[model samples]
Target: MDTSTMIFIAVGLIAVIAGLYIYFYNKDKKTLPEAPAAPGSQELAHSKQLRLQAYERLVILAERIALPNLISRSNEPGLDKRSMQQLLTQTIRQEFDYNLSQQIYVSNEAWEAIRNLKEQNIHIINQIASILPEDISGVELNKKVIEFIMNQPQGSMHTMVQEALSYEARKLMA
Candidate 1:
């Protein structure tokens, strides 16, 4: 080749070699292997703190939902059928409403199941009331309510309550 031709070929060879080096050097980057996570840093610690706050909120929610406030607000020693039904249903709704803030931290499954369980418990209380004689004593009525709760279907209420507790626990973990 002539002198100019030789210089041109040299430049072309240099460009090709540089391109190859860059291509091979960066090939691994296209499929980066996930590096194992190291120990927690400041940011990680902050994230953990946030998670702990979420857990606390969830626990509060669970408590509010499940607490009885010593005795039900609508307690009536001689509640008639309509009054009793309203009281039982209102108690269920009040419990759920009081825990309304907890939905943010808990899973959809947990919240939905808990809501369903509360409804079912109210329904069960109503069912028990339906079979009672008009002359049933207050003591007997209270016993019947307790018995209905004891015989709730397949530990359904227990499962929902447990799930709520689990959600609170999971929130605390990073």
Candidate 2:
């Protein structure tokens, strides 16, 4: 065979090899295993249980951090206004940090509401403390905090967060 004819034959053979490789590559993909099926009912139930527990913890956290409850829990006979303020603020931050992970299982809206409530409560505590005299007694600080919460037109942050948590939990149950 002449050089041109041999070259043409070699080119044809290369094209055939390329075509076979392309065909087999796609054929192998078709024989591969499919993705796993969706999770079973038991798995779903477990997830729901975890979500419910998270909501429960969040509700309890909200109640615990409520101004009245916090004041009742942290009040000390000899603590001055600055000390009381620090106690309350620290307690709120600790409670919030403890429950921070629970946010993953809750709805975004519910989580945001809980966060907002925490911030608002901290703001209220700091605002009241700032307005009071440094040497004022803890009892007086507590009274002022309670009064400020009571005067809020929409009620306290804790109540609102608790309500939001409850609503989310109910929706999940249904």
Q: Number of backbone collisions per candidate, in order?
A: 0, 0
* Global fold similarity of model 2 (TM-score): 0.75
lDDT for 85 in candidate 2 is 87
Compose the digit string of candidate 1's lDDT tens values, residues 62-156. Answer: 44434232125445687665566666577667767876666675546455546654654565555556667766654455566664444433333
lDDT for each residue of candidate 2 in 22-93, tens digit (9 for 90 to 100): 543554365435335465777778888999999999999989988899999998989888888889999999
The per-model lDDT (C-alpha) reads 0.52, 0.74
Best by TM-score: 2
Q: After the best TM-score superposition of candidate 1, give how far the Cα of residue 106 lies from its true spot, in angstroms.
A: 1.8
Candidate 2 at residue 166, lDDT? 84
Backbone clashes in model 2, listed as residue pairs:
none
Tell me the lDDT of model 1 at 92: 62
- Deviation from native of the Cα of residue 32 in model 2, angstroms: 35
